[model samples]
Target: MEGLQLIATGGALPGRVVTNEDLSQLVDTSDEWITTRTGIRQRHFCAEGETAATLAVSAARQALERSGLQPEQIGCCVCATLSGAYATPSTACLVQKELGLAQDIPVLDVNAACSGFIYGAAVARGLLATRPQDDRRYALVIGCEQLSRLMDMTDRNTCVLFGDGAGAVLFEAVEGAEFAVDLGARGDMAIETPPCGPIRMDGRAVFRFAVDALPRTLHAVLDATHHTLDEVDWVVCHQANSRIIDHCVKKLEADSAKFYKNMDRHGNTSAASIPVALNELAETGRLQPGMRLACIGFGGGLTWGGMLITVKGSAV
Candidate 1:
């Protein structure tokens, strides 16, 4: 299969920044308590009139602009999220309309919970591989979440751990070295949501699952690619918890400096976490040409996956 290079990245967060102290007024929690447990001090929440689709569109536009690619040049649009404005039309469809992308192209959404971004990247790679070689096909992959809408403000356990945001990247098909990809689901509801109820989770179960699944997935991808930890420039895991990342780093016995994290400010944006972290790295000039990144995510649906990608400079 032809390799897909990440040519550009972008992210968008809601205007309202809610700190742990802010939640203290509504719920029985303190900044020190939340920070010690989740390593999250603040998070962004959507205000009136803001929706997942809107954030997705904003992030997508930034990515498109950064890539210098016209909207029509994109061959596919894939959005990863569990929260959408409506269940009928996928978030990708709404993004396509907002971005004025080609009408004939494939546009859809996927739900892998916190692992959704990595899942979306895998889907985009497969889609781009099928396109004609003569055409310069690109896939716009986005991870957007509106978790605040599902939050039970009174439930401190869940409410303090989530935020609203979206992140995006433009993947361009290129003839280059292929990278490894792996995806799996255990069909467990350690984390779940019902038809009308707010988000609920078994915190201990999730923490245990993440710590184990994350390093395993990272090593699986590295082994599949015949690479080693020393060769990877960055390890971007779902920014669900700082503790999970710390545990995975210790267990893997890998260089702690290689792991990237931003949960301290954005908290957990579910599907949006990894991409948001990627965007931050790119904006800060940390992502450079030829750098290898191992992206992993684990969450509800009990899904976990990882993909190895080589960073390519923005499209000319």
Candidate 2:
């Protein structure tokens, strides 16, 4: 009743699955090398007619169905993405039109790279925190990205490290369902950021940043929520690399069983990673009502964030 609660979640991926063998034909990397380094075997790419908004609409519609909410009932739409399919039209507005949302409904885009989902979640949290508890309503937050289009097919380093996908969650204010989100950006690390033109990465440097940043972010979020490591049931982080995930868990001394990962199928979808991972946890029945879930992500922009959340139910 006082803070934002997750009501439902939905995710969408491309119909086409690009395997490492397929990538081997396009680049010099092999399936074994890709899997050893990134734990990604395959990932989805958007089909002919599936743009960002189309995938977003598909996800939002499923979230609405799970939440039992009509199109007009939503207060706003928040889309977190980097590849929005256009330079001018906001992807949020496109999803709004596709959903037939009300004219006055606000829709905005957040471009925080992989941290976008938690950033969007924090935005919805702030909105809920400001509104009257009795009248506070729902906001659809979706993290969707089409990284396949941005990949440099010839660059063996980055080509096999990304895929396209989308994931969505419905948030509303309710008692006992709350989150403690901690976010930060390192502007000074701008020199280390990826290029603006295409996907470029210093895998070793990124590995170092993730190893250092994630543990601290996790502690900050845990402290903000007054939660102990033992209290957390699941850790749903951006599926960037299995090695980074392992390193972060070791740094936090978190239970290995509670850390969820499925990057073997979906590479770094950038902003879509965490939500897609969350949706996977939901599908597997690992993320359940009354469970405490922590989400953490780091990506380009040299940005990162974490959210310590308490789930209310499947149908909040």
Candidate 3:
């Protein structure tokens, strides 16, 4: 087991709130169809000048402010996304520049689709471990996405299931805190985002993978940490679908109350899902200091992972 300061979390959604009724105009799907299938009632879409990097900065700024730490104190930045507006300046770099963070720290983007934020956190942990000189070792892990730009309205199957948003988790190292993580990737392409094309996904195939991944990952990290399902206060899975979480709850025979979800409003914001839900918990006063949580994510690259974290922070 390891430790995390878990300083704070913050989230940002686009200005354009597109409802299922609105999407019906652009595609052949209806609110009933999307709700019954994905449990998504609405989603946010970026307007002019609202790129992934901008959203990342917004979320990270909120987190930094809440943590009561100046930007220059941040030790590193890791942004996870599949929809960065540009390939040259990674979203993490843009966040560092816009936030006035230190220029010499590690700043890079990670791509593991829906499972990206967890990966980014692991990367940040490794990077922070290498720098023993820094006193406050804060690392900002951001999961930002702009999937609306890649939505193919013609293909209602995939188009109606994504949105644009960013979630930033800011944390530092704290001793005597319990932590465990497990990450894995299986070779598969049920979902993909091509270079010049829109999003493509095999919905049924992904559902199968997700349902299986959730419990296995929850058990993986929980077991590694010598904890049980009862010991976990929350299980925040990737907000991909309602049915997937429902099925996994039944499979694990765990309390449904422990699972937190927000996909209904945000849709599946790719890598932003879990951290976004965490931000919601914080904003709503649900996440508190010392609460035990198991966070899981699964998606393209067919990557999947989960980690156990004990919340640490002074503010709600």
Candidate 4:
């Protein structure tokens, strides 16, 4: 059997594109204000008929096709989101129905804000460890959000910073794979939950927390994996801002050309950022066989995580 594998990934967004200029017409913010502060020029928004689950299923379909897997082959479904339309009926269940997954397959939902993808991945990793050989064990891990649903569009501050989208990754149980995972949370840093609506961030505060926490998180994962920065081929971090990306690379002294980024095109997709970027990289043939990639993310709940994986032979 192969070791735990990120076989393939897929991402989907609403057809509607919301440019900063378009947002300016709705709110008091300017294109300059959004660009200067968040490094976001535009983002996608969900259409009238689209919901979080629908976008997630679209993403899952692409991933399943790329991976050559079927709905019944997946033993687990993990959905990561903070903006689901409902509070009950786990989003993963909704995905299971949409994907025609087996009734007995475990369905789980995780809410770690932007860090949700890493959290979902970690859960899928544990699932791989527990399943028996020849069990057809696989997990459909997704990070999705329709943040526009939570945005107080009347308030210019955060209205333009978020959009709606979904991204999915297929994790398969295999053998002979190298893996290192580290996850952390700071309760003191957490924003009050429930009724706070989705997320209301103090940009300055979150910036400080992220800059201080990410390096430590990365170092922890490196130490656990016994790998050095120079050994990494690609560093895929949450695409919140170009400034944050620049700061993290400088602090780690990572090679500029080796970093993978899509912020200029997608802005921030919240939980969907990393996997969306991963799919983009795979589609463009930027990530190849036998490469090592480090995935990191930080977000609300004041959480952060990092996962280091040695890319096995690629099928694409």
* CA lDDT of every candidate: 0.90, 0.81, 0.89, 0.80
What is the lDDT, from 0 to 100, of the residue 260 in candidate 3?
95
Report the CA-based lDDT of candidate 3 relative to the real structure.
0.89
Lowest summed lDDT across 10 adjacent residues in model 4 is found at 189-198
Q: Report the C-alpha lDDT of model 1 over 175-291, residue by residue, as the tens digit.
A: 765577889999987899775459999999999999889988998999988999999999999999899999988898889999998999999999999889999999988998989
Candidate 4 runs further than 4 Å off: 1-3, 189-198, 313-316
Per-residue error for 222 in candidate 2, Å, reads: 0.8
Misplaced by over 4 Å in model 2 are 129-136, 188-196
Candidate 4 RMSD computed on C-alpha atoms after optimal superposition onto the true structure: 2.0
TM-scores for the candidates:
0.97, 0.93, 0.98, 0.94
The candidate with the higher lDDT, 1 or 2, is: 1
| Best of the candidates, lDDT | 1
TM-score of 3: 0.98
Tens digit of lDDT per residue, candidate 3, span 1-316? Answer: 2366577998999999999999899888899999998899999999999988899999999999998898878889999999998886899989988999988788999999999999988888888878766664888999999998887878999878899999999977666678777899998979988965599999899999999888999999988889999999989999999999999999888899989988899999989988889899999999888889899999999999898888888533
RMSD in Å for all candidates:
1.3, 2.2, 1.1, 2.0
Assess the local accuracy of residue 251 in candidate 4 as a C-alpha lDDT between 0 and 100.
87
TM-score for model 2? 0.93
